[model samples]
Target: DAGITQSPRYKITETGRQVTLMCHQTWSHSYMFWYRQDLGHGLRLIYYSAAADITDKGEVPDGYVVSRSKTENFPLTLESATRSQTSVYFCASSIVISYNEQFFGPGTRLTVL
Candidate 1:
């Protein structure tokens, strides 16, 4: 039984291109989150969803979009990929908002050249 999974593990794209990272969890977690990790920024929240059709922007939402059509899946899309967007993206899920431990996927490493 898989706890969480991320697609494409690694991607290389050009500037101005569009890229989507897929994330799925086997657990029926109530809260899902997207985060990007960089050298200086560390880990920054990009988006989050509380439930199906209930989504919200996180600390760093620009240049990215997210949607949760199901309780177990949350996808993140980069509208127009940029070199600065190159980072490690992670997806996490939790049973509740800040009260429970979060389960994170392996991660997707994206490089925009």
Candidate 2:
């Protein structure tokens, strides 16, 4: 099936290490978003891209970076992983931010030590 997908379904890393979570979609959605699901925060947006090479910071962008060099790919990277950063990360895509429904990929569970 052609849909959005996340890589390394689960990840474990130590503090200060750099880790990248990849998201890819075959549908060529116009917008892509990265969110972290935490205990307190329901789902906070980390970053989003309107189109290839056009990215913007969302609600929470600290310690994280995102880039969309291709419409099909949106990767989120942690410059320096921290224990507090460990959470379930979800990647979503939508054709229109206002009306279209967002399709989400299976989350990547990250554990930082």
Candidate 3:
């Protein structure tokens, strides 16, 4: 089965810099989600797309952007990444949110320097 994974397990970036985090899945699930894990955030959704060219903003959509032009790949870009954005980013996919199990990628640790 095709699984999901991420790159640059660790990242050190400064404020006001452009950083792109990559997410790739093999299952070809219809639903893909981007979430940032923080102390109090408890995995707040950044963005989610049901299909290609159809994306909707999630809980905390500010300071980040997502694009899912394809079914197997979704990338997140932080325009002018900020210190507050320093957190572990996780990408997950599932066939359905209500019953299907959500597969989470290894995750990308981004730090603002």
On TM-score, the leading prediction is 2
- Name the lDDT value of residue 39 in candidate 1: 86
Range of the 10 consecutive residues with the lowest summed lDDT in candidate 3 = 94-103
Better of 1 and 3 by TM-score: 1
Kindly report which residue stretches of model 1 are placed more than 4 angstroms away from their true locations once superposed. none
Worst 10 residues of 1 by lDDT: 95-104
Assess every candidate by TM-score: 0.97, 0.98, 0.94
- Per-residue lDDT of candidate 3, residues 16-110 (tens digit): 99999999999889999999999976999999989888899999999888898899999999999999999999999998667888899999999
Which residue runs of candidate 3 sit more than 4 Å off their true CA positions? none
| Tens digit of per-residue lDDT, candidate 1, span 1-113 | 99999998999999999999999999999999999999888889999999999999999999999888889889999999999999999999999997689889999999999
Instruction: Report, for every candidate in turn, its global Cα lDDT versus the true structure.
Output: 0.95, 0.96, 0.92
Instruction: Provide the global lDDT of candidate 2 against the true structure.
Output: 0.96
State the weakest 10-residue window (summed lDDT) of model 2. 95-104
Candidate 3 contains a number of clashing pairs equal to 0
Across residues 1-113, which tens digit of lDDT does each residue of candidate 2 receive? 77999998999999999999999999989999999999977999999999999999999999999999999999999999999999999999999789889999999999999
Give the TM-score (vs. native) of candidate 3: 0.94
Query: Which candidate number would show the highest lDDT if scored against the true structure?
Result: 2
* Clashing pairs in model 3, backbone N/Cα/C closer than 3 A: none
Each model's Cα RMSD: 0.7, 0.7, 1.1
